[model samples]
Target: MRKLRVAMIIPDNRDERRQYDRPEPEFGPAPAALLQGLQELPEIELHVLATTRRPMAAPAQLGERVHYHLLPAGRFAGLSGLYLPAVRALRQRIQALQPDVVHGQGTERYCALGAVFSRRPNLVTVHGNMRAIARLHRALPFTYLWVGARLESLAVRRAGGVVCLTRHTLREVQGLARRTWLLPNAVDPEFFRVKREPSQKPWLVCPANIVALKNHLRLIEALAPVAEKYGLTLVFAGGGDARDPYYQQFKARVAQHPWCRHEGFWHRRQLLEGLARATLVVLPSLEDNCPMALLEAMAAGVPVAAARVGGIPDVIEAEVTGVLFDPRDPADIRRHLQEMLERPDWREQMAAAARQRAAQYHTPQAVAAGHVAIYRELLQIPS
Candidate 1:
């Protein structure tokens, strides 16, 4: 039988290339995990497409069947929603490959535009709901979020299908997309293998980029009193700009509270190690669509306490696999944190259940198989 060729358009982290000074391209956790899963399937040939501003010496092939293609694009074009140049370049390259399907990884920027414009049997995955986020943040005209929301609407309408990370995202995009599928993100296999050795001092780790949407400052305010009462430490692990007002505020607040520490942008291995030692993982984002951090924590057998907003409820069962709190209310965040901290046995039970759930649904192999099924359906291939 002939192999199914799939072209995946995704964002590659350029900072990782410069930081590590390596020739290999790095992707965000969810895409990387999906790639890991896809590699396990012998029936598919994968071609990964990414845009970079500067040239990096990346190999043409990543594995036996997975190939990589890098295209040069203007840094600001996609940010402003004027991504025709990037889309045209991507379409030209994708046409040459002539894959069975083109899967755009996210609608935040160029990937969705490129995939839809590829004029092939293409689908886009909505990782975050840009429209909801723009409203929540009151995004200014022509700002990244504002532009992204409009672009997302266009891509969803034009694409063959839209893959939603959760039902919340499905609801957000159903009207715009011709067809939509609720598919959860995958956790890295390494996370499932992390050796848990919880620190003697209880600490909560939050792995998310520092931004207003992520609600880092609000999280700090909510957890400060509870952390003090329990002698618990709160660790922040994710990237943030030094000049951004929100980032600066987070740093200033962390300084004032001796119990809180901002580690700032940890690599995969570092994050896994931190997860293993953490008593619990927390997320206080104003809105999210199946965040990779919570999924990773579940895979690592770490109990999660997150805001009960957006798709978080879909991933976490209240008082079962994890605890949920209101992101808007400091009292609610404090109450949940206090309850979880006081009950060691309950926390352990939640961790065990979460690990079981992660194994059943969020593994790379499981998610990969689900994606392949979708591709087959789109291509009218017999399952």
Candidate 2:
């Protein structure tokens, strides 16, 4: 049988290239995990197409059957939501490659524009709901979120199909897209392999970027009493822009409380290490759609306490695999955190259940198989 050729348009941070001065390209964790799972399958040939502002050398081949292509895109290609140059370049390259399907990773940037305009049998994954986010922030005209929201709608409407990470996303995009599929994001298998090493000091780790929507300030305020009472250390393990007002406030709050530690950005290894030492993983985001942080925590055998908003309820079953709380209510957040900290046996049971859930549903191989099934169905190939 002939291998199914898939062209995946994704974003590459160019972090490894610039940091280590190496030529290898790096993708966000979710895409990287999907690629890892897909590569192990013999029935597919994968071509990764990533855009960068500056030129970077990348190997032509990633593994036995996967090809890599790094293309140059304007630094502000989709800032205004046009993405004309990027779309043209991507379409030309994709036409030349002539893959069976073009898969765009996200709609917030140029990837969705590139894939939809490629004029191929294409599908796009809605990693974030830009329209909802823009509305939440009341994003003003000409801002990134405002522009991205418009482009997101356009891309979803034009694409042959849409991959919704959760039912929340499905409800958001079903009206816009031609068709939609509910498929969760994949977790790196390495997360599952890491052995848990709980910290002696009660540690609650929140591994999301310090942004307004992440609701870090509220989280800090809500968990303050719990932290003080239990002598618990709360760690924030993601990056934030210093110029942002919310970030400034978050830093001030973190400083006021000695128990709070903002560790800032961490690589995958460091994050996994932190997770290993974490007594519990907490996500206090105001809105999210199957966040990779929660998925990673589940895979790492840590019980999660997250805001009961968006698709979070889908990822965590209250009191079963993990705990859920009202993000808007500080009291609810405190109650759940306190309960999880107080009941060690319950936490352990939830952690075990969460790990089993992650293994069964969100594993790389399982997600890869799901993607292949979607592709075959789109192509009308017999199972």
Candidate 3:
């Protein structure tokens, strides 16, 4: 049997993805790893297409079946130009390669345009907020969301299938199309093994970028009273342009408050160490789509205190696997944090459940198999 050509579409730069993309390679490897795993199947040929300003060197082949193509993303058309000449170039490449299926990663214009221009039986994956994320930027939030929605709809119309982080996320693009599938983000239990020992001063950890809608400021502010009264300490793990106005205010607040410390960004291994020692993990974001950090925390046997938004409600039960709070209300987050501290047995049990769930669902082999099944169904092949 011949292998079918499956291509994954990504933004101009792997390191410069937008809000849904997070401009960071480490946070979302949906492209880097997912495609690799699919290629491992002997009867499949996988390709990755990403936008780039200048030409980039191709990676050495992972397996005989996998290939990568880094096309140059050209200059914007004119004033306030976002469409690039490379988009057309990509269309040409897609025509020539003629992939059996194309998968999109982020909401970046290049990826959407490339896939639209490709005009193939494609898969568009929503990492988070395809339409709603624009609300975060006040200045041009309307334009951002409007254009993104229009583009996303066009891409979905062109694709044969859609993959989302959770079922609730479909509410954001309900009428956009049919054939949407649910697939949550998962963690490797081996890498993030749980270590539940008798806990001490309940330490709180959050591994997310300090940005607006991530709602970290309110989380910090909530910590003030908690620190003064309950005696709490927080460790933040991630970095961005801290000098940005929102982040600057957050930084100044952090400086004034002695209880919280921003420890920059840690690699996956180092982050595992932090989570293992943590009493609980807090994911207080205004919006999200099953992020990797939450899964890692759960796999590491650290209970979660997250906001009730996005695909979060899909994964976390109010007091089952973990606790849920109002994303907008840091006071709510503080309450959950304090509750976890007071009831060690309850929180630790939640952590154990989280670990068990992660190990069962989110392994590389298991996730790979699930994805390959999607591809096979597209190709009308048996597993």
Candidate 4:
């Protein structure tokens, strides 16, 4: 059997290149894991093209089967000029590689939007609904959302298939793509694990980028009142650089609160450590699609208190596996937190249930197999 050439394009390589220096491992094992999983097909040749502004500390010779291409890009804030360059370079790279499929991850500024221009069987893995959130950029205005929705719709329409990280996002992209794949995100079982016993403290955590869509401000607002009533310590981790204006706004608000400890950012090990110490995780985002943060937190035996938006409800059940709260209403978050905190054993049961759910749904092996199956189906390769 001939090997299938695969080109995996990632746009958010700035953090992967360690440019921020803030230390959340910016881009973690996601790209690597994707390549690793695809390579497991044996008849697949995986080549990763990570395009970003910051240079990567990559090896001169990564491996025979694996190769990395770094395209120079301007700072993320000033990406307008680099878009044409990236699209041209990426198209040229795809031509040279002649991959059987062009797989793009997320709504990566360059990868998903730019790479979809290739007429090949492009597979876009959109983790969340950016169009819905683009409406909330504040700085970008409604015109931006209108333009973004058009482009994103076009991107979805052009792609041969789309792999939505959750069903919630799939529903949003309805009538756009010719084919949609319900491809959920995976977690490193080695890192995020099930707890043998419950921990002390009603510590709730939400680890996500300080983007507007994340609704960190709402989470902070909820915590202020929750802390007073529930005696909970809300720890905010995994921050963004100055580009994320929400971070500054959130910081200003958090400064007023004495109990909230914004840890800025932490990597995988440190994140797991925080999860280990916490009683529950809260991701009251306005949007989501199986956010890896929520999955990782759940896998670590920490229950989540997240919004019922996007694909989150796909992962968390209301009061069963984890709690759900309205993202916009801080008082609602506080109320949910109060109720969850009140039931100590209920929280424990939910965490245990979450761990079990992770075992069934978000494992690396299962995720890899699912992708392989989907690819085989897309190519119509006989079993």
Candidate 5:
């Protein structure tokens, strides 16, 4: 049988070539986990395509079978939701690769649009709901979201199939796509392999980007009273450059609380280390879709106290796997945090259950097999 060629279009936030200094590895959890899983199948050939601000000598082979292509972006990269130049370039590259299937990582960016323009057997994975996200982050600039929604809708309508990372996303794109599949995101194995020892001091960590939807400000205010009563230490990790306007505001607010520590940004390794020492993981997002932070925390054997929104409820079985609270209610956030801290036995039971759930559902092998099955179904190939 002939081997199947696959082109997986993912984001390129790790543009090391653009950096003047030596670049750090930023193999984002989603792409890294998916690529690792896909590469294990000997019958498939995988190629990754991403958009970058500047051009570089790419189409570089990362592994035995996985190759990377970094397409150059147009001047109006951010202003224009979809970079037309990159889309044009990506279409050409996809033609050259002549893959049996073109898999787009997310609809939030230009990748999905590129796949749609290729007019190939394209499949898109909805990593986020732009229309919903736009509503949540109304305080910030919403031009991007408006543009993203339009492009995402077009891509979903055109793509041969759609992979919804969470049912939250599925519900929104129900009538948009011709075919759809529910597949949750995967966490890196490092999250499961980490060695954790309980911190002598009660510690909590929120490992989400400092965005408006993440509701970091509310989390800080809600935890302030709890921190005072329990002598708790909370660490906020993940965000863009510290100079970012939104981050600056977030940083100023975090600095007001003595107990809150804004660790700025930490890569996967650093985040794993923080998770190991954490007493519990907290996510107070106004909206979310199976966030990698929550999954990583569960895989690390740490119980999560997350907002009951998006695809979160799908993973967190309320009191079973982890505790769930209303993201809109700061009081609810405080209450759940207090419950997790006050009841050690209950926390332990939840943590054990979370670990079991992660092992069963979030492992790369399981996630990869699900994608492979979807691919085979799309191509009408025998399993």
Candidate 6:
């Protein structure tokens, strides 16, 4: 039997200019996890296509079986919905490779647009809800979000199949495509293998980037009273440009609270180390679609207190795997945090349950198997 070749498009923030110049190309967690999973499959060969802000060196092969190509953004990259240049660049690559199946990693970016442009048997994995994001960002400075939303709709309508990361997104993208599969995002097993040693003092960690949609400011305010009462140190991991207006405001607010600290960004190892010492993981996002941080926390055996929104409820069984709070109310955030702190036995139980959940569903091996099944079905191969 011949091995199947698959082309996957993933989103990344690697410095393309320096990628070939350096020994390695920096990849974020999502692509890293998926690549790890897909590479482990013995009968499959994989090609990855990603986009960069500007033109750089040409295509580069990462491993024996995995190939990566970088597409440079043209002058209209930011203004004309992200990934416009990717469509032309990726289509050329797809034509040359002519793989059995082409998969787009996310709907909100050039990956989907490029896959559609490839004009192959393309499958798109909807990462974030662009329509919802556009609605939230309509009044914000970024008007491209609205354009991205429109492009997202176009991509879905044109895709041969759609892979939805959560049931929430499945419902949102229903009727747009005939074949839609629900698959949760996978977490790296390294997070599960991390040895957690609880902090002596109460240490709370939020591992998301400092963005307006993350609702970091409100989370800080909610923690103020709790921090004063319990002397808790709240650490906000992940970083954003200091020039971003929302981040500037977030930094100003973090300054007001003596207990709050913005830890900027931590690479994977540092992030895992922080997660190991954390007493609890917190997420108060206004919008999300199965955050990787939540899964990583669960894999690390830490209790989570997060807002009950988006795909969060799918992974977290309220009071079972983690505590869910209302994102809108600071009181609710405080209430959930207090509950997680007050009940030591409950926290331990939730941690165990969360770890078990990560092992069963979110592991790379399991997720890869799911993708293989989907790809096989799409190709009409006998099971």
Q: For each candidate in turn, give its C-alpha RMSD to the true structure in angstroms.
A: 1.6, 1.7, 3.7, 3.3, 2.3, 2.2
lDDT of each: 0.88, 0.89, 0.70, 0.71, 0.82, 0.84
Candidate 3 lDDT, 17-120, residue by residue in tens = 33323322222544554554565678778776765554445563545677667665544521135555656767777888888877677554657556656777
Best model number under lDDT: 2
TM-score of each model, paired residue for residue: 0.96, 0.97, 0.87, 0.87, 0.94, 0.94
- Best-to-worst order by lDDT is 2, 1, 6, 5, 4, 3
- lDDT for each residue of candidate 2 in 1-383, tens digit (9 for 90 to 100): 66899999987777223443556787888899999999999999999997665677788988879999887766554454377767877888899999999999998778898899998999999998999899889999888899889999999999999999999899999778998889999999899998988998799899999999999888888987767779999999989889999899989999999999999988988998999999999999988998999999999999899999899999999999999999989999999898998899999999899999999999989999999999988888886
Model 6: colliding residue pairs: none
Per-residue lDDT of model 5, residues 339-382, tens digit only: 88999899989998998999999888889889988989999998
Candidate 6 wrongly placed segments (more than 4 Å): 15-23, 53-59, 71-82, 139-142
Give residue 329's error in model 2 in angstroms.
Answer: 1.0
Poorest lDDT segment (10 consecutive residues) of candidate 6: 15-24
Backbone clashes in candidate 1 total: 1
**What TM-score would candidate 5 get against the native?**
0.94
> Candidate 4 on 1-383: residue-level lDDT in tens?
66667777765445544564432222445554555555556676677775555545554223556666665554552234535566666787778877777887766456675558765667888765667666555435446555555556767877778898777778878888889988677777654544434456677777877778778888777667457766667778866777556778888887888778788777767787777777778887877777778888777888778998878899898878998878888788878888888888898899889888887877777787787677667787754
Per-residue lDDT for 1-383 in model 6, tens only? 55789999876555422344544566667767878888888888999877666555544776768888776756555435465666777888899999989998887667788787797888898888898788766735546677778888999999889998889888888888768998888898899998999898899999888989999999987878778788799999978878999999999998888899998888888898998899999999988888999999999999998889888899799999999999989999998899888888999899999999999999888998899889888888765
Model 4's TM-score against the true structure: 0.87
Error of 3 at 164 (Å): 1.4
Worst 10 residues of 4 by lDDT: 20-29
Candidate 5: C-alpha lDDT: 0.82
Better of 3 and 4 by lDDT: 4
Tens digit of per-residue lDDT, candidate 1, span 200-250: 878889889898888888888887766767898899998898899988888
